[model samples]
Target: MSEANAPRVRVLVADDHPVYREGVSRAIKARPEFELIAEAEDGRRALELVQELNPDVAVLDVQMPGLQGNDVLHAIKRDGLPTRVVLLSAHLDSETVYRAVASGAGAYLSKESSRERICDAIAAVARGEVVLSAEVQAGLASEIQIRERDQRPALTPREHEILVLTANGHSAPDIGKQLHLSQSTVKTHLKSLYEKLAVNDRAAAVAEAMRRGLLE
Candidate 1:
């Protein structure tokens, strides 16, 4: 298609901050190849508009009230929506980056990103490309390194069951009863679980298991 006749990228701008949202809306409007289709003040509204409008791109704040940006992104993925999500956040922690990427956000950019950069990300994501700001990239790298450093050993099926039961605050005897195993076998599994998780106590084991995503 000729540049002039090409369809403008349908865009949704969502942020809790009115000034920032308006600025982004204005920037999208100023772009000849883009169309500002909707604005939302929170993640819930953002997701509602995405479902209702089916815009090609959604610019979302990562830390909005109600649902978070990643929450909306996950919803879009769950529903098989074609709308691409671009997450903007002032916080660039490693955990945040990991969650955003894992949840399938098309773009993750810093709130400090320029309007042009944010718009560029929207355009890139609309074309099904992944975009990440330098800060976000660094955060992701940190998260990867942290995960590698703290990699947990693979849990046996029995150990996994024990861990799940333990997370639910089940006593050793209770877990044994539920699994139809002897108390001695339960203690043995608990010992193995503690060793594998590198923790001394049940509470620490549970915390480490959760941190490693071993307990879901």
Candidate 2:
């Protein structure tokens, strides 16, 4: 069908990683069936641009600097944006998969999925079909198994990063400056990490996190 005759799919991409975002944009542009309307590097921008663009579909990264993919999805719902969301991520657990499924996302795609798979995901979401990549499915299964075997403190990727920095003798202010967290936020994380790692000092906390594989 002609581009006009066929249903045109407008897409918005939201990813914090610049390389992945650009790769996705390039992949979409190389396809004939999809038109990429705008690009966003963070969750807030994603939500804002989606509202402005009113694209037919939005490809969102699950872990962003603020307002994660699901949070952005909620914002879209709250604002009644016309865009349908397709969550893209490098990692997600079974609980997260089910949660995203329940959160009105149109699709879930792992970043490791093939280029053709991405295009298919976009097309499927535009058609109101929910897509799940094979890698995403497998990762969810593996994550569930690991979760079942775990009875320890769970920290976010950013939190884990902070834990590592603090262990290396960085003060809260220094950690905040490096990771873009506030001083109070850095201290809060340090306190939480100390408690979680069962350490009384920064060195102890770092050692514990490293021992537990929470940090490199």
Best by TM-score: 1
**Model 2 C-alpha lDDT per residue in residues 1-216, reported as the tens digit of each score:** 765689679989999999988998999999888888899999999888987879999899999987799899988887877788899887766778867876788889888877788888899888889887776677667765676448457887777888777767888898989989899988887788788777787888877776776664
* lDDT tens readout by residue for model 1, 136-158: 78779989888876696778999
In model 2, where is the ten-residue run with the lowest total lDDT? 143-152
TM-score of each: 0.70, 0.62
Task: Name model 2 segments beyond 4 Å from true.
Answer: 1-4, 138-216
The TM-score obtained by model 1 is 0.70
In candidate 1, clashing pairs total 0
In order, candidate lDDTs are 0.92, 0.83
Winning candidate number (lDDT): 1
> Candidate 2: global Cα-lDDT?
0.83
**Alpha carbon lDDT of residue 37, candidate 2?**
88
lDDT for position 166 in model 2: 77
